[model samples]
Target: MPKSKRNKQVTLSKTKKKGREHKEAVVNTMKQAIENHNSVYVFSFENMRNLKFKEFREKLKSTSRFFLGSNKVMQVCLGRSADDEIRPGLHKVSKLLRGDAGLLCTNLPKEEVERLFNEYEEYDFARTGSSVTEKVELKEGPLEQFTHEMEPFLRKQGMPVRLNKGVVELISDFVVCEEGKPLSPEAARILRLLGIQMATFRLCLICRWSPDDFELYIEGPDDSDIESA
Candidate 1:
């Protein structure tokens, strides 16, 4: 008799991966954005903050659409090569979607988009495993910022602190974080408690694509050229 197939282990190659439908939806949405908007941009970002990004998205909801997801999916949506491109020069834009990048499809003028992208920046709290950019030290003194109830919590975070006359006092100088070092879980929590924000979230435009032209900005574009595009 053949062994029962029930509860049998399956080979990895035979196991189906999920999210095909989701990737298809993303591709469809991107294609629609390309059709609906006058221009599309490839932009790179640093220290992405979801809530702040959501707020930024809300501000441009009426005139612009942003897509942030799998780079491979985005590339496929735009087509990887000129032969398969959905639009005349979109494949050029797709080639720029390398790392920490996204798409912005908009009807706004190029000048306005550039100005907004250059001016927009947000400061957010650093997370664990994020590199510290500055030294954060707490001098030996009374920490008026924290209440007596926070004493135990501070101590658990490796802070040399105690409750003194209902105020949290640092018994000795404490270095919460150091520059050029990766933040630890306790260091992140302490920095949050102290209201220190080390992460700067910003977006930079890499290139622009329109029905008529394709422009790359890394080496810089002439003012006349940008205006004409």
Candidate 2:
């Protein structure tokens, strides 16, 4: 019988790695933006909503550029030390790029940017694992908000709901979520169905850098303060 090669072993070196090209492209783009823009900013975000962010980015496309990705790649682009920084004082900005932070290069005046960031905030539905800010409870009564056909769906979501004479009814008081506790999958779904939004998707600026100087806006202990970049 001839030897069969149904399965062949492959060497580690033969495998293709991902994201190298993307990293290189990002590095090149950052360098170019630094050369063209008068200022750069480090910003952080909470409860990010991609659609809303896309809309915000589109509005500033004519005057500014935003970069959000791996912090390490951005740090590398700015360089890690004063000696190797792409620009003077850029390494300081690089150091602040930790945890859910991104870069912004723009031609807008600092005051205009600060005002825009300060006034921007959007509310969104909370997701699983998000902490509930307030208690959400439903009293025992007929649920006119939902049709009888939705009884089964509500029951599946852990609600004490039943169909009573073609209407959804609650047999007992139900607590969808409690304050200071993380939301479960069931709770999140219930809140959405109830049309209650809990998450605030906002961006906050951490620091700013220009050719002449660098400034730190977040000098307080709580860097999580909400504002725009």
Residue 59's lDDT in candidate 1: 94
Deviation in Å, model 2, residue 107 alpha carbon: 0.3
Query: Any runs in candidate 2 off by more than 4 Å, and if so which?
Result: 1-17, 220-229
**lDDT (tens digit, per residue) of candidate 1 on 67-105:** 998899999999877789999878788778888999999
Candidate 1 stretches greater than 4 Å from native: 1-18, 219-229
What's the lDDT for candidate 2?
0.90
Q: State in Å the error of residue 211, model 2.
A: 0.5
* Per-prediction TM-score: 0.84, 0.89
- What lDDT tens digits, residue by residue, belong to model 2 across residues 113-142? 999889999999999999999999999999
Q: Alpha-carbon error at 127 in model 2, in Å?
A: 0.7
Query: What is the Cα root-mean-square deviation between model 2 and the actual structure?
Result: 5.2
